[model samples]
Target: MDLSSELSEFLRTRRARLKPQDVGLPEFGRHRRVPGLRREELAQLAGVSVAYYTRLEQGNGKNVSMEVLDSIARALRLSDTERAHLTHLAKPTVKKRQRAAAARPQKVRPGLAHLLEAMETVPAFVLGRRGDILAWNRMSRALFGDFDSWEPHERNMARMIFLDPNSRDLYPEWECKAVEVVSVLRLYAGMNPDDQELLSLVGELSVRSEEFRSLWAAHTVTDKGHGSKRVRHPLVGEMTLAYESLKVSGDDPDLMLVTYHAEPGSASADALRLLAQWGVDEPAKPADVPE
Candidate 1:
């Protein structure tokens, strides 16, 4: 992916989403060619020269200062994630040498795997940067179905959400879930533009799923954190579960440990207990086991 082009398109899309009135600019009754604030208007708001801002938008501002970037971010009314993405695009840290030094396949630490196993009632899983399910607990299998059944390359959450037919039936709010997956992926893409696997995943999804393509084009970026999702599990039926996403400490900053829980004494909680019991009675297929 061309950083310059990505930066230019990201800025253009963000600029196009805003309106003159949004930034307290009065409508001048002039026929506007662009949908959002004009380059001059944005420049005025950001306290920069129109020429400089234009050059930045055109991907020609090589020596862009942090102060200028901040001003532009403010002018665009960008969110925290969007601002971070802008900074990354303006000055990416990953170089050709860094990209060439391919990362080894991620594995769950024994301690973390043991920790996950101990959480018998909680559905937990560790996800790699590209949403690959690196490791998951027994309850996680009960909640989200058998990850071991999937082909190694097909273990990505984004891929499953878009390509797996079962996912549509599993999540009642499929659209919302799908959007979140795309936004999170977009965030990762901004951070690691040169990741060949990630690029390939995006390429495949963009070609195969119209919905994914549309969301990807929107350039929305989001950080994964605590959230609630209502899912309809085939075995357990419908349940609203709260989930927390934490970064795995140690060498792998890109790996995330996600755990789902329900309110104490709630029906969802009971369902989880039942799911755990089911897992105990009939052991889930191990990750190494093929379908």
Candidate 2:
């Protein structure tokens, strides 16, 4: 992930999504060459000189101020997440880029692993950055296939979603699920562009899947911690599950606890119960969910 190229492409894509009238600017001509607002139009909207904005767009963000970035963000009508991504792309951490290729492994806490085991009737996974499943419980295995049998790199959600054929059958709205996964990965990339593992995963997926390639170029960003998903499970058929993704607050802020539960009275809940072996074969708590 080249910082300069990424910043240029991000700003270019964002600007290409907006029109003059979309931001209250009057439509001046019908023969516009570009799809969206011109560079001068954006500069005017941000109250900056065209030359300065052009320089920033070309990825020379040195000495740029947060105030100017915020003004540009407003002009582009960026969401909070997108704004944060913009800031990150403009001012990446120099040390992370200069650091060694080896990134420290992300770990899940022992207590959180116990909680995942206790969620016998619920499908739970302790995911690290880039959607790597560091640990998971039996219910999760029953619901989403046996993660224990997979190699460490194969346990990643993004990899499974895009490269695995079974994943297409798992999600009824596969495109929606794929977009969400890709968006989350991009958010991570924005903050940590120099993550070697993440880049390697992205490169592999891009080469293997056409869908992943297209979605990766879109540059969507989201930070929502909770959502609902409809999964087409092989054993239980199609069911809707609401999920919460909570970040661990202490030393491992990168680890996220993802838990999935069905509505109490819905058919999905009954399906989940069946997957848990009618509450009979639940396993004892574990010391930690191993990666």
Candidate 3:
């Protein structure tokens, strides 16, 4: 892939998403020629010349300083992730290196696995960059209702969400879940551009799921954390749970730890307790928790 073209497209797309009113600019009450602020307008706001801004957007200027980048970022109102992406794109080393490491499927850290064993009351799991269910605690197995019998290739979360009918039944708010999936995937793509596994997963989803394809085209990226999810399980019926997606430090690209919780004394919390009991009482199904 052409890095220069990618950089240009990303900046241009982000710019196109903003309106004059979005940045507190005066609206002339006339038919606008562009959907967002023009190059000249943004340049003026950022204290740069239109020609210089145009050159940077065209990828012709490689020696852009951090001060200019920060100025542009401020003008565009970039979030932390977007700001990082811009810096990554502008850095010479990212373009100089060709050996972008592919993402390895995450393995449950032994300490994390032991921790999971200890947390019998809640469901927790490790998800790799491609959203593969790499490892989970016993209660998580019961909560997700996925038998552990799938081959390595079928273990990805995105695949299960799009291809598995069970996922549709499990998540009551399927559309919201779908958007979350796409948003997280977008985060991964920006963070790990050369991950072959990630690229493969994206290709497969775009081919098989129209919803996935549409969302991918929109180029919406988000940081995933501290979200509420509604899940419908056969054993527990429906429960709304708050989830936290935490990054495990020192891990390579795309590995994370996610856990779900409900308030004590709530119906959802009760359902989770029931799930823990089920995990203890039921026979250990290795097939239910595939390797």
Candidate 4:
């Protein structure tokens, strides 16, 4: 990917999402040509010259500083994920002679596996940075369908969302979920341009799925943090459950713990109870279950 172009387009797209009134700038008139904040207005907010901001948007700011990047992020009212993305793009790594490397999928941590195994009531899974399903509890396998049975490197959520028709039907709000996947993938691309596995994943999606291609070009970025989602599982019906994504400290960049829970006595909670019943007779062993 072209870092300069990616940086430039991303900044422009973000800036275009804010208006003068949206950022507390007084509304002048409806004669605005662009969609969001003008270059001069954003420059004033970031404490930079209009010409400099223009150059940056045009992909010519090679000596950009972190201070200025933060200022721009502030001016744009960027989220935490967006701020970190700006920092990553501003400091593109110097090219190395070694070929770009794919992330080597790591084994599930023993302690985490034990924890997931114990949490039989809640569906949970461990994910790596690139959206790989490293491990999942039995309930999670039942919740997300049969992904845990797939090999780690092959069980990417983004790929499934785009390529698998079953997944598209399973997610009630599939479009929203698809955008979130692309946004997170965009962040990963900016932060780790040398991840050949990720690049290949992107390439494969772009070639195979038009939805993926379109969203990828939008250049959005986000973190997979806490959120609630609605899923339309064929067996359990529709459910709205809250989920938390916690990063697992490890040598690998792609590692996090995700757990889901529904409010007690709620319909969703009842559905989860039913889902857990499938494994009631099976061994409560971690290794036996994929998710």
The candidate scoring highest on lDDT is: 1
What is the Å distance of residue 137 in model 1 from its true position? 0.8
Instruction: List, residue by residue over 179-260, the lDDT tens digit for candidate 2.
Output: 9999999998987877888889999999999999999998888874898999987777899999998877887667788889
Model 3: CA > 4 A from native: 59-61, 92-105, 250-254, 283-291
CA lDDT, every prediction?
Answer: 0.86, 0.85, 0.75, 0.82
Candidate 4 lDDT tens digits, 1-291: 777888799889998999898888996887988889989999999999999999888877589998998899999999998988877777776355322334443677677898888898888888775787777777887888776466655688897899888887788899999999999889888877777777889999999999999999888899899989998877788899999999887655467888999988999999988888875776543433324
Clashing pairs in 3: 148-287, 148-288, 148-289, 148-290
At residue 58, what lDDT does model 1 achieve?
A: 91
Per-candidate TM equals: 0.93, 0.92, 0.85, 0.89
Q: 131, model 3: CA deviation in Å? A: 2.3
Which candidate do you rate higher for lDDT, 3 or 4? 4
Across 14-125, the per-residue lDDT of candidate 3 in tens digits comes to: 7888888888888786888877888887898789999999988886548888999999989989888778777766653543233344433345656666666677777887
Candidate 1 wrong stretches, greater than 4 Å: 95-102, 284-291
- Clashes per model (N, Cα, C within 3 A): 0, 0, 4, 4
What is candidate 2's local distance difference test score?
Answer: 0.85
Question: Residue 88 error for model 2, in Å?
Answer: 0.5
TM-score between model 1 and native:
0.93
